[model samples]
Target: WYSTNLHWLDALRHVALNVTSVVTTTGFALGDYSLWGNFSLMLFFYLGFVGGCSGSTAGGIKIFRFQVAYILLKASLNQLIHPRAVIKQKYNGHRLDEDIVRSILTFSFFFAITICVMALLLSLLGVDWMTALTGAAGTVSGVGPGLGEVIGPSGNYATLPDAAKWILAGGMLLGRLEIITVLVLCMPAFWRH
Candidate 1:
């Protein structure tokens, strides 16, 4: 489902010539996104880290889990509103337990916190705010490019110091692996079990 305007044009233009979609672009849409305004850029950056469906190669937290989290969170809030109400949250026509919901919430929290911490570290390395924010998001999401002048599609990471590069690489690996797997591996309890 992650398709493109070019693909849409190619698929539709042959069938309907009346549609007046005209554009001549040299590079990919990723580059086009990098060229968007700050608000649009930030949104894409968010979605980039909160990726496609589960089992897809695309990185970041999958959509279904986020939905489950939202539903559970809302249901929990509703319980406070009406103490005796019985509300059940369902995903994919199946019921989810408290443990599963808690796990998803914890994962999302850590994922966001990790990005912010990485961005702070990047800022300490003399990277500007936009670059740091988008860079952290892109790295953690495995999206490959950040916003702003240096790290955007028009630029490369070659100019960054070895330390910064290593930090970003670690973020990429952690994000791709999912935060829990790496954290669990780091814990002594995981080894004992």
Candidate 2:
């Protein structure tokens, strides 16, 4: 909206790039998108926290989990204020059961734990704290690009060690499967059943 572009193709191209950038969270760009400023970049970073549809390949904490958590959080705060208020968690006109709410909360907790663990792992590998943090975030989010100069947009991950790369690859798999799926298979009980 700042500059006037008469070409319709430019507008379409902009929209396409913007959507794909967040949808995949790979941070690909055809131009100087950094001009969008820190707020926009931060917004895009937050997008990686919001995954696409359940069946889609887009990874991160799926949108439904966020929705469930938001509803529950709202209900909790309302209860705090009203004390005797009977609050209900509803979405799309349907009430959420306890199991679904628990699952969402568990997933969110595990996701955050994974990020922190992975960041610690990277830092132990001699990576700077900033790189380690964003690298963990990107890998756990299943997003290839991260913050800082090394793994950020226009930077290749080749600088990382083989071990770090391998760890990050595992992180990607964990993220894609929502962590619990793969972790469950590692339990000794899986084979007994």
Candidate 3:
């Protein structure tokens, strides 16, 4: 891809910097390619979810969730191969209980659903579909720079309406709080304490 639009070294630098920033949830971009089709831009949106390690500043669903999902999938495949086999999922030397698996699944579901909902809201605010989707992903993952000309790495958020900014800010908070934490706070029982 770089061979088409940039010098080899420049492309390497941009790609490396972009990957590192997105993975770490910093979202700094050295270049902006709004002309890239959705197929390519969508990857960045999803990449926002592939955040860094547990203790790092990264803000997507986090690599931990992906690990659990992979383990669960492997366990399912193993079960398919041996219907009567007993299988347990483990991560980082810790045995994963059923509840933890369920929680991870639930969190992933909500994360995806919330991204869609946020995108919808942004579109209603007049943001284009591409911008809305990428913006929602970036904000929800706390990745910061979306795709597209207005919100891309080179684009700034200043052009967006105040309502859209507010929406993004709220989305960022949801991502930063891990969704579950904020949801738990919303529970009536939590307030009773």
Best by lDDT: 3
Ranking by lDDT: 3, 2, 1
lDDT of each: 0.70, 0.77, 0.84
Off by over 4 Å in 3: 33-40
lDDT by residue for model 1 over 1-193, one digit each (tens)? 0233456555454213211110111112333445435665566566565566777666768777778878877998999999999987887788888788789888988888989999899889988888888777777777766767787767877888777888899898888898888998999988994
Superposing all C-alpha atoms, what RMSD in Å does each candidate have to the true structure?
Answer: 6.9, 2.9, 1.9
Answer with 1 or 3, whichever has the higher TM-score: 3
Give lDDT tens digits, candidate 3, residues 79-186: 999999999778988999889888988898989888999999999999999889888989988898888788888887899999999998988999998888898998
lDDT per residue as tens, model 2, 2-90: 44342668856865776577566555755444344677567656876886767788888877778777888899999999999888789
- lDDT at 104, model 3: 84
Deviation of model 1 at 175, angstroms: 0.5
> With candidate 2 superimposed using the best TM-score fit, by how many Å does residue 118's alpha carbon deviate from the native?
0.6
Alpha-carbon runs more than 4 Å astray in model 1: 1-30
> Which candidate has the highest TM-score of all?
3
